[model samples]
Target: MMTQLLKVVPEPQAILRAWMPFKSVVGVTSVRTADDYVQARATVDALVDEIRADEDHPLADVLDYLGEQVKRYEDVHFTIPEAQPREVLRFLMEQHDLKQEDLADCAPQSRISDILNGKRAISKDIAKKLARRFNVHADLFL
Candidate 1:
């Protein structure tokens, strides 16, 4: 005669007990300080380097979660003044030490100068190229 074995399922809290340690190990906690935000940002940058634009990457959710945490901290502590798209572009250009000619990959120097001077607006195609070059969201240029 053979004895049959029974499988036991752990309770929800017990499952969480096993998960919390792993979560803390990966630094997945609420950002409450500048140090916490820095750590979260580092984790997000690392995740981006690993995941790139692959939505199917295993760490995509982790990146999203950490990104949200970083955004939350910034929303509370760092409020960016709203500005027009051209003004934003100018500010980014200054910050990056870029000139109209430096944006040749995004647009013609004349077009870049026009946009910076408020004589013309940024088109969607140029906005996409600028976003890629600046490593920022295209909506910033829009």
Candidate 2:
């Protein structure tokens, strides 16, 4: 049955011709078509299921290949923004339910107001205090 299916399906090279752009982007010239991607995904999923069902299965190579392919696809598709100082500060304030007055222990109420409103920058001392209070990296404020 597998041999028959292989015979019916176009070879990997033929598939690559149809999916050259995606193949080039993923650095995988061997993958030829959308069907090839689907087949690879299904193979990876099956390997994962088999590994889950039998932990002792010798699937190291399969797992490594799946991880590489998945990572390549994800890198080309998924993007996440890095946190900025203002965003980090806002997140901390929201998480702690803190108001400008609540920051009096760290800085003057006016300073906190200015910092929150982006009117004033956070100094090293303030960054340290905020890092301690929010349990975050001080560099986030810098």
Candidate 3:
């Protein structure tokens, strides 16, 4: 029995079309050092945020691929140190564009200010409310 081989060469136009979105992600599909990896990581983060904003986004695969590249680079070069609860709280506040007054339902504005300034510890009930408000784990506030 003779085995038959099918030639499956991709069309040039199709290849170009597929490559169009990848123009900004120069590092993911190639070997990269620390600097390029950082740049790619930032690009991937922005792309992920953009994709997450749309429920039926057409760029999901691109986001997934970018995430994988970021994970790979992070596995080799990234070191994340544990942050204090206050720092985490501040980060969440910044991410949500929240001021102390915005968290009034969670706590008094003065208490929120004290927590941010490290003058007060995050209380259990306040942590729970904050967790719900920020949509993050309560332990982050704890």
Candidate 4:
């Protein structure tokens, strides 16, 4: 015997209906230029503030769409300055609450400590491994 967990999804038409009214109300569109991008980002922040304890409010999808627009604009226009490998490593470790031993799959604990402490440079091979483990671009570690 197996236990099954079922979840309900809103139908396409229902989702479209829910989205239609708010589109005009919020004035969201495909963000093509900088001004539109800024407006959409502001809209996303406003929507985030508006949504209270109810996580399932119908406006969640609109919030998601707005966030996607901001991300698309950033991908095209914004470039993150290259960071030192050790800074990147330290940031990832702190952000993820990981310790040196946690990354032993990528290298020995001592090597990880050395990399994080800037005593060693990250080789291309180790960069690739770290990128895969952290789910980030390899260039971030280079």
Candidate 5:
């Protein structure tokens, strides 16, 4: 006799309804302690996985809830620093393998060196030149 394997498929609507109570629980616990990280992350991961696995799942609702949780977690943990002008210039130069001499058409090599060495500020004129050369916003270098 051959035995058939039974797959326990959950109804999407039912899963969504079950998710609501869990979401509330996670929301209440999200700011409590470092211990909450594992639980919160697990809840989000499970919801995302379920949504991916079942197209019939309330994808928009799941995504919205997951996005909120992710934002909350990131707000608590991630802090991005503002990039300085010289650092931006150095990053751009390194990305393009540009030499200081190559920037002469844009600005003087000494000016580029001074900016990179934190001895000079990026003036509006140089910012525009860099913007044009790099095809990026001037604010990036400012």
Candidate 6:
């Protein structure tokens, strides 16, 4: 005599019923196009605002899921080159329409000029000041 194996499968109707509301509320099952990716990105942003640094928040896993989806789309569609700290600072300054003298709160004009010219590195104190001024993390400067 031979033993037979049993297989179990979920009911498709039940799965669909459960998934319909979830997909509607969550905005995506997966990112398939630019529009879908945008919706997923917006949802992820909302989740981040709600979740902040709380790993135990109810929607933390949802944020992680959508973040992964956005990352997948970006990895396929975008190529971000690695930028040096000086390059990052330059870009931020340009975006803010800032001259070296405008960063006087963070550093002296000469220091800022040296940093832009790659002659001086940004110290932690300067990084913190820039982060506060630009509303960005200090790690970008470091």
Per-residue alpha-carbon lDDT of candidate 4 for residues 65-90, written as tens digits (9 for 90 to 100): 77677768777887555688789888
Put the candidates in lDDT order, highest first. Answer: 1, 6, 4, 3, 5, 2
True-structure lDDT of candidate 1: 0.78
Model-by-model lDDT, in order? 0.78, 0.62, 0.69, 0.74, 0.67, 0.78
Superposed model 2: Cα runs more than 4 Å off: 1-81
Q: What TM-score would you give candidate 6 relative to the actual structure? A: 0.54
Q: Which stretches of candidate 3 lie over 4 Å from their true place?
A: 1-81
Clashes per model (N, Cα, C within 3 A): 0, 2, 0, 0, 0, 0
lDDT of 3 by residue, 35-130 (tens): 766666566556544553353678766655655665576557654347888898888677547688977768899999999999999999899777
Taking all chains together, the TM-score of candidate 3 against the true structure is: 0.44
- Rank order (by TM-score, best first): 1, 6, 4, 3, 5, 2
Task: Give the residue spans of candidate 4 off by over 4 A.
Answer: 1-81
The TM-score between candidate 2 and the true structure equals 0.42
lDDT of 4: 0.74
TM-score against native, each model = 0.57, 0.42, 0.44, 0.44, 0.43, 0.54
User: Of the candidates numbered 2 and 6, which has the greater TM-score value?
Assistant: 6
The digit string of per-residue lDDT tens for model 6 on 67-96 reads 778768867885435687788889878855
Report clash pairs, candidate 4.
Answer: none
Candidate 5 runs further than 4 Å off: 1-81
Candidate 4 or 2, higher TM-score: 4
State the lDDT of candidate 1 residue by residue for 1-142, as single tens digits. 9998998989999999988996777775678899998787677667766765566998878777777787788778865568999988988787557788877767899999899888999999899877655546789898
